[model samples]
Target: METEKKFEPRIVAMLCNWCSYAGADLAGVSRLQYPPNIRVIRVMCSGTVSPHHIVHAFQRGADGVLIAGCHIGDCHYIRGNYMTIKRAKFMEGLLNFAGYSPERLRLEWISAAEGVKFAEVVREFTEKIRTLGPAPSFEASPRLATAVL
Candidate 1:
């Protein structure tokens, strides 16, 4: 009997440079253990992560997308995280309307000093993505469908 291969989800993480990115760097320097599934893209602010970027990641085979920024009232650019929060909600609703599972997208606020929290967030989100499996867009791509057939 053959054992089934486990599915490993690919996660795209967009981290704000001021806080989330620094937190992730700290996590790395601290040697904190977290899932190795994330591919991080550091942005100046989470507010800069547009809906197009999120859709593009899904189209390009990312199983999930995570947007992380500084905590409320602590943004390097005043009110940047507020914009992030609003955008994330709009994106989630839009994705759901477009036949995608909104759960595949996540948003978090991590301060520069929260290395452990960064690791824990990555671990938890990775597990959630694993449970959700691949993004529907990936599975439904015409190229992938033809190849599978």
Candidate 2:
């Protein structure tokens, strides 16, 4: 009998440099164990991650996308995380309207000191994505294209 290969979900993580990225770095330095399913993109601020970027990641076959930044009232750039919160909501709605599962997108706040939290978040999200299996749109329409610009 042939053995079936396990499916591993691909995740795109957009992390804010001032906080979430630092937290991820801390997680690494702490030698925390987590699934190696995510490809992280470090941005100056989570607020700077545009909807276009998120959608583009999905278009490129990402099974899940994580947007992490500083906690509320703790943005390095005052009011930046506020914008992140607002945009995340809008993006969730837009993605849902586009026939994608909103659950595939997650928004979280991870402070620079929260290394364990970072690892936990990644582990939880990875498991969630694994349970959801591959993204429906990516599987149904492998050649779907959109102009992100």
TM-score (all chains, Cα) for each model: 0.89, 0.90
Report the C-alpha lDDT of model 1 over 24-132, residue by residue, as the tens digit: 9999999999999999999999999988899899999999999999999999999988888998999999988978899999999999999999999999999998888
- State the lDDT of candidate 2 residue by residue for 76-97, as single tens digits: 9998989889988998898889
TM-score of 2: 0.90
lDDT of each candidate versus the true structure: 0.93, 0.93
Candidate with the greatest lDDT versus the true structure = 2
Listed per model in order, the count of residue pairs whose N, CA or C atoms clash below 3 Å is 0, 0
**Which residue runs does candidate 1 get wrong by more than 4 Å?**
1-3, 138-149
What does the lDDT read for residue 22 in candidate 1? Answer: 98
The candidate 1 region of ten consecutive residues with least summed lDDT is: 133-142
